[model samples]
Target: MVKKQDQVTHNAKPTAVESRGGKSTIAIKGTFPEKYFAKKATMTITPAIKNYNGEIKQLTPIDFQGEKADGKGQIINYKEGSGFNSVQNIPYDPAFGKSILVLNSTVKKGEKEIKLNEKEIGEVNMSTKRQDIDPKLVYKNQTSDGTNYYFSEHNYIPNNLVVKTATIFFDFNSDKLNWNLPFNQKEENKQALSELFPFLMDYDSIQSIDIEGWASPEGELRRNQQLSNNRSLVGKKWFEKELESYLKKQSKETKSFMKRLTYKLYDKGEDWDGFINALKNANIEDKDKIINVIQSQATKIQKEQQIQNMIAIYDEIDQKILPCLRRSYFKISCVENLRTDEEIMRLVNISPDSLTKNELLYAASLTNDMEMKKKIFSKAIELHPEDYRGYNDLACIKVAEGKTDEAKKLFENANVLKSNNDVVLNNLGIMSYQDKDYGKSEKYFNESQKAGMDQSKNLALVKDTIYTIDYQTKPDIEETANDDKTKKQKSEDD
Candidate 1:
């Protein structure tokens, strides 16, 4: 008996091959590499001998120096020969789209050199008139490969830059926090605080602690003042609670010993401790001096705390910085458990609510996760919509999502409630421009510019729009094509 023959056909889908313009042309998995670089492009880096920290400074450049076998270590190519030499000119390809080709290098005091790879192709050097660009580009600098270089990658920052940093780097304004935390968590104040916990715990000698809060020189004086106070208190309180809790988990003897002689807390509730302490330590080793210091410090700290309490209820002053301002601190009383105290405090400080909304918003903005930010800001808005800051913050999320209409309305509401708010006006202009309403955009942008907004680029953008409008309105190919086909034009010519 003849068996029925089975028929089969291979109708597999094609693998996708990316086009130059960033789209898939065909589909077939094995035909394409798992990943490919974006088209390479050239960029020029200029070097100059500028006075750096009162000394003639030059850029120490290095080539790709790692072993080629490491895949990442290969010297793809250098614009010129590699050596410790003055970089007169170097051409290199800008990082292959997002793929960075980093060359680790180092520099010496009073030494200057320049190096180039296939990525660097040009250089322009000028006087310190270009200081602004340095701040914009050189958020961090580093040294590697025997030369000084601006760190283009986050991981390279600490290794390259050197400055007058305290031994306790992360201790308030110390350079320690400059190091990038795990998973970009450094941008998150809470995460930073969270990370700070273990550090504090490690320090067993810290029997007392003080946290002073500061504010940027913006916003209402009263609000800023109150915010700084709250933040100090909250920060201290969190640290104390966390330390106590952690201590409670220790051996009974340890816990009892720590409790009896470990905890001492003080929150000047504002930025008054330093000033009062200075006055107290003002070279008078007498009781009168101590009394004066106590009186002055007590008065300022008490008044600041009272002001913060009032501000907490002031709906109109609902700045997101309030929580940062409303911070309390843990001041360890005795020298014992100081290490435990610090560790516990750091852990407390790192908790989710340890940071202010502004900090969270700033951190969220750095990540690719709009949903996370939206989830956070959205809830904040719902809880505090009447406050200008909450609405403004929510509007920022809307803007990120390309919801111009909604963002514009929100900005308008924010502006109406807080007329002096520059962020609302600036964002309103941004939304208007994004919506292609150049006229409205220009108006808002001008208002922002006149208000001394920090973003000079916005003013330039408004001018660019005006120029674009002029060029677009001028007769062009489309207008000529319409004229050529129009009967009215032909009749008028005849």
Candidate 2:
């Protein structure tokens, strides 16, 4: 086949054909105009095959001579037959079913070179047919959730107060707190007092203190009231003296801390409530009868008289309950400070163990780098295996990495730790959707929505996927009808 200028034409028969191998040699002929070959030029002809997929396979490159100036100052003309006539062997290739010949020519004079127009000079159509290939879905990385879980700092106190109460008893009819009381002489009382002394000295360490004083019920109503009030005053005075002594021994910084301290005093007169509580819990005989008498009596004096009349159980009451009534109760609450964000971040790298589980999880959320997030989350899970946030966040990293199975397992583990975690459930739903488990995906999405997760976008995506699947699988009735009508018309025409 030969393509003339601005037109393509084919000869009736091949120039030469090999009988044994069936390889055909086709002659390609073309001529350049005089001005085109005036300069000393070089020409190259390349034969190639173009496949159905738009890829080209080269056959062979042919070089041609150019016009050159002779020693006699005359031009040695490059004739058409010598420079443009060439034959190319076309081989059988399933992919290269269509072939073409391209011509490229360059002109050179001394150091200057110029490229001529490259042209498609010839074409051939082979007998082979092109094969069909199936298309596939290309996998793409998904965007991150951009949601972060931070550790709550405000109103969050880490240290819990170890509650210790010290009770000092008073003798019957006495309003003063005896320093030499038997209860005060006990080792536990000394330990309790020791635990409370430091908090009293450092105002920053203590939140508050409550002092309550009580008197036994077997007394005059007015006398008992006066006794409870004086006992509360005496108890408060003793603590104030102890605090003053503590401040005297401390430096100015600690002495000044007393300014922030707060104190509350309560006078529990007659201790009737304490008496009823003691009676309810006591292991003595006629307990129900004593409780009934106390409940039935309308007046405080009548109750006292009824209690004093229980001569058999009076010893039990004096030894077991009355001493508890004639006493002072001191309750001290201490302040707990939380670590700052900067301090927690600094320690996370150097000493991660120093940070709480929430702090470690929060550190992961503070950075956008995936590798750093993975490291922090790994450390969080290692430190606190029971917390679900660590597992859920780490699973997000796995999902971004295209490890869907690993992400599913991590999400399941997170779910086991904290059942129905919104983030975990949402991620699992996404995984199921990606795997084409539509029913399972819908189930997870519904559950996630119930768990307070925003699944509107995810649900929309699932609906779209279902529609696409249905559309692709459904039959085309119009196309089938048209095909049948065309077949019948062709039969009638035949």
Candidate 3:
């Protein structure tokens, strides 16, 4: 029997994740390109931030960044929050058959509008901050003005598309993140650091952040104090140096920077007030004299009420707040006028899913631009051949542009790899229909239906079209025999 924990289908593909607690719900509905369905996926939640303490009631709102296409999308909204809990769902590609998720927690708000299909959803109202309007939606070969998902040929279908949302906790002290060593002192960590620095640099727009270093009280008080202080200084320098290097690589044209990067360094030497006090009550340490001494110092620091004095008080609580006190981070401020899509896309192709290499190729066919479609399709084929989406998508482009012979060859290749995919069967049927081979067309159409490409209405339309082909091909019989039979029948009736 499968265990309760096993119900999540750890090995099976995941579509999305859900919040563990709290009643807030997430609803996702989006459209895909015409005649296409997304592959099975395992959705992983990456929590970027969390507020377990429940001290903060609301998080800052910010636009969550995601791309339907591998590299051809943008984050064009104004507000995403920096709240305590932010969760993202990352999907993997089907063609590559790899499992991956990039769930991140952000301390931001979730109300941001994206321009899809020239309509907007999840957008904030202008007069009031509350969201009041349903933005437009665009899906494969169709657009929704708000009430309907309409196809290009004016056909309408129910808005059956739904997206799953989940909340995940992002581990900060992890040895590795997203298969990259986040804090390791190796090549993997270097790459992780590289990724981190870009986001950290963005925070430099803030006034400054406080950097307090701490060391366990294992040795002499004075020695531990200085050691902690030195460590903070080292971290500050590393951050500063990395920032400078990143700025140098930005662009030759920019001569100015937004905010000055700075940090305040402090060290709390050998003072385990928080930890030691807890231990004292538990009789783990019989150091009344020591506790008394530390309490006096803590009381004095609390009275100061200055930033420097606060650091001292904060240090006193490090024992009780091991996670917060041992942490090293800087406050970053938001800036206006960030880089454009053309600029970011220039750096790398934004993948639809980290695990899915083939899906990126599937996205290539979605591109209407011929040049881009060819480039993405080639990359997809290079990555994986076991999957038929790549071959079929590329073949689709051929059929769209009237390259029937080339499309037929591509279909043949795809059939060899996967005989059951409806997409390939449907395309093959359409190709045969267009080629004026009525018998071949009927065979392909039947095959498509057998393969579960069962659109009765579409099949009916195809059947009607066959009559047009017959009338064109058998013009002599239509012009002579059909007219004589009709004339005889009418004369008899009269």
State every prediction's TM-score relative to the real structure: 0.28, 0.42, 0.26
> Which residue segments of model 3 deviate by more than 4 Å?
1-359, 362-366, 465-494
Q: Where does candidate 1 stray beyond 4 Å?
A: 1-366, 387-390, 435-443, 446-452, 464-494
Q: Residues 188-292, candidate 1: write the lDDT tens digits.
A: 444544444444454444444445555322234565565555555555555556656665664233454445343332423234444334334444345354344
What are the clash counts of all predictions, listed in order?
71, 0, 46
Model 2: residues >4 Å from true position, as ranges? Answer: 1-165, 179-182, 185-189, 199-206, 244-252, 334-494
lDDT of 2 by residue, 273-356 (tens): 888898889887878888898779898888888878874556878666776688777888775445666776688789998876
lDDT of each: 0.38, 0.63, 0.40
lDDT winner, 1 or 3: 3
Between candidates 1 and 2, the one scoring higher on TM-score is 2
Q: Give the candidate number with the greatest TM-score.
A: 2
Give, for candidate 1, the lowest lDDT window spanning 10 residues. Answer: 1-10
Clashing pairs in 2: none
Residues 133-163 of candidate 3: C-alpha lDDT, one tens digit per residue: 2222122345333211111111112222221
Model 3 local distance difference test score: 0.40
